[model samples]
Target: MKMAARTKARHESLGLSLEDVVQMYRVMLQTRMIGERMMQLNRMGKAMFVGVADGHEAAEVGSAWCIRKGVDWCVPYYRDVGVALVLGQTAKDQFLGVFAKATDPNSGGRQIVNQFSDVKAKMLSGSVHIATQFPHAVGLALAAKIRKQDHIVVTYGGEGATSPGDFHEAMNFAAVHELPVVFVIENNQYAISTPVKLQMAVANVADRAAAYGMPGVIADGTDVLDVYEKTKQACDRARGGDGPTLVEVKCYRYRPHSSDDDDSRYRSKDELQAWLQKDPIDKAAAYLLQQAVAASRLEDMRQEIAADIEAAITAAENDPDPDPATLTRYVYGEDAE
Candidate 1:
């Protein structure tokens, strides 16, 4: 089926094929589905914890889709399931991580489910301390520059992390050295239980980019295409040796901080329902259907993805836990030769 005139024009302007856009929507859908299923598993006591990725799929998927996977580096935070998936991580990999199975590629079940790293994908694992990834990302970018490589690093964190000291240091270092890195602040309007209004004095997180002498851009995280366009521009600038760009994507969080927190204490049901009306998955599905993509075709895609998720869950469940004997292997360094 042919794309709608408007859709085709937009993709053409961005130099993206219709198939590429469809793939973006597909990844977003899969990410959302994986989060939902993970939550169900948490409720069923299959997993220890879960973080919801419902509202941030567009921001995560759109930004990651712009990168060259293994060619570029990604330092994603705890809620970046969509980013990990786009960076060559399979649903089985995610499930294994969540299940804390010995087969978990990131940490062999030692770290949290979201702390993902793939050496082959050039994606770094995140830490519990917020904003720590910024410094690591800056280091990666600095190394690439020293080696005269064309690689760029894409790092993600919440607006709340911007308050930390490391955030400033990383930004300053990147700007001073003209490091090729893109900092994405996924401002989901809440830092766990604290609302954005309570977290900082500034309105937009991107506003702080001025202090570090870098360009700042704001985009609607709910609009996948808009995000893709903005991120692509930032990455291109970095590749051209123009230094880092701070992108603040305004979005909403549909779930609580984690499987443990109660969101109703700080947020009203009405507010969440309002954001649900603008859900990225729903928006993309509607747009595709309008472009002559049949509803049956979309449903088939959903079914296929659901089956893939289930298969991952089954494989992870069958996998064993990390052996106790190997518990301290990675925790501490061994004696040097």
Candidate 2:
């Protein structure tokens, strides 16, 4: 793809109907609230780790929903808060993971690994390492192929991971083997303090896919419908055995990269304010109202979501912590007892 292609292909809206946008509004808001609440958990002494996805909702939710859930796998990164929730990680499960409480979806309090999974849902674990899941997702796609399954794999990342060797190797090998894997990059313009322009020479991450002999396109990631439209095409391409695709989703991060790292240290106040002005949730909600969704209904929905989130927090707080000794149970490979 040409360097200017992603930018050129983008900026044109795909004309997603208001109904589709309405359907996804609740999930988007919930994910944003969840991300914000997780920060509260951190400050309140419940969570030890939190990777908020304040700005990456559209990319995650749209990508996850576009795929044939459970028929395809999603290897999400740490910041994939919306995608994880869309993949069925209930509020309680996520907060439970933060609380290290029993009954957490992934482990029932036994493991602190991926938050949730159901082969039927096709949602895999969201890893913490930048591009580590790239290879693992390829392995999963390889298994699906060897078994003659039709399932595809979706590997997501931020623009930062594009610089890693794992991203290159995974794309190269997936192309060579003709594996079913779609690489999605949520290019939020910045990798923490490092701006994306400084991270790579290419104008857009999607343009770099040509080196791997794959189609690379950019999506208006802030626009959920655009994200959905682009990702749906990529999913179709992978399912048809056309091989991998690179989708660069242009977005912005409204908050710090993580709890321990504050953007104020490196980013100026004006930049942060600029991004916040384009908040995805507000955009979706506004579109919903414009679509004629009842204002009362919207308010009720918000209240319901708040109630549910609060309940999840309470459950996470009330649930007992994992046994201190059991940390070693799921840590190592099964022993030859």
Candidate 3:
């Protein structure tokens, strides 16, 4: 197998070794497979709901790869399965949340599916409200700065979240205080059924970053290496006391917004097909192939991932539901009783 001259040159320029790119492809693949399985479970009535990161894997995984998992913090939105995975959440962990099992670390079955949390991983539990995690990320960054910690915080949201006051407030505060945080907007071009054009007049979400006094970058969301390079620069700047950056990754979701939404009324089939041609997973696979990774190897990787997902589903199904007796355990203070 011969590596393409362009592929070799591109990765080398990014300072990533061949092994690093391969591992990144693995994470992206795993993220896609996990999301697909979750959606399948939703259709089977085994899971209540699912918000997939089908086309946003590169953005999530690439940005997450720049963070030091346990040291740095990730305040992810609900649709950040790839971020959670890269930050140390496993297939089993995601399945636990999807099934709302007692072992579900995020909320112990209290919260909705895809609301990821892991204290050990420094991933803040996400909420149902859009852009709410922005303030939380800012708070964490503030704490890190005050404590003289070297760690930075990376927070994620959709482009539509940029319309929220929370997003502005957090960005403003972070910039004013020179907090170490990176704001990543996975702009899939739609906020559920609402197109990006209806949400904002600006051409790109990153265009708003200048108002907050931070660098704004637009990365190709379908290209893992491009996303990694852009996010790495932002993370490096934040860690170096250069304040925050607003990165808008241009991507598209292949699926409907969620299990409940119908995208057909809002999006044309042609538009969907056009985006599908640039599928992040397929792009990464092609890159791998050009880099001498065998097709059989990719197929075997998929099989292994599928088997792991099956095991996770079985474990999650057999796990007990949260006990009714302990329903109020984490909800209320003991003094309140």
Candidate 4:
């Protein structure tokens, strides 16, 4: 479906130039393409398991765009491929990780697929355990505060993570300490097979933010501009020493929880179809067209990104696997070399 008519005034009000909007759309498109390719690889049995950020591009890209890469820190969850891409992780880098190649930058084939990390980008490696990154983010923020640094930390997780004790502990500590951090909950309406209704009694995940003494803001995750604007405000507040803010982006994931999941067992096909109608990439493209970006230009952008992803996959497939002798290298101090 087409998004509301895009106006120059709207993006301008958000301090975004037309070119900036175009670039944002490009990132969203690139994110979707990469996820799709990963799923294909998983289906071909080239990758053991995969998680696609099929419907989370806008939320991930928009919020990530607000951070100063290499200065501010990002502690993202597993489904934040768009965040990693925005923070300077290349498509080849991601492909290498998924292919479990020796040169994989995140962990040299040690970590699971999609557990993204880039040292130069200041993005921490994600843990397999849910809500663990919340405390990690708060710790990073605490360090920044002690150092009198201007940078802030941003952490992301699904709504299911909010139900964990670590999430609550991190939020309370960050709030009490007035730490510079932003807690981003990408509420995709489901936690594996469990829907949000079963996860919490609250109407929204942001609603719980007030209990921790921070402002809670909700944004349309399908709208890149809205996500960018709200996340930017929260980031600015944290950078200005106003402490943490909980920003909840309402989104829907088109794919199953993982390659191993069978979504049909929990959600109905009609429901999936309904969410597909509001695909974030389509919404972004519609806005671009309304901004007078030629349709051909959008198609060409897709083609370019598709070719790039194909090249990345091919290169990653050809890359060598980790040697058996190095299995205990990073796991042991003396064997690291």
The TM-score values for the models, in the order shown, are 0.95, 0.89, 0.95, 0.96
Q: Between candidates 2 and 4, which one is better according to lDDT?
A: 4
- Candidate ranking under lDDT, highest first, comes to 4, 1, 3, 2
What is candidate 2's lDDT per residue for 95-120, written digit by digit as tens? Answer: 88777676676665654433444444
What is the Cα-based TM-score of model 2?
0.89
Among these predictions, the greatest lDDT belongs to 4
For model 3, residues 60-150, the per-residue Cα lDDT tens digits are 8888889997899999998888988888888999999998889998999989987878889998877789999999999999999999998
Clash statistics: count for each candidate: 0, 3, 0, 0
Tell me how far the alpha carbon of residue 169 in candidate 4 is from the true structure, in angstroms, after superposition.
0.3
Query: Local error of candidate 4 at 228, Å?
Result: 0.5
Candidate 4: residue 268 Cα off by (Å):
0.8
lDDT of 2 at 11: 19
Clash pairs for candidate 1: none
Off by over 4 Å in 3: 1-8, 333-337
Q: What lDDT tens digits, residue by residue, belong to model 4 across residues 222-268? A: 88999999999999999899999999999999999999999999999
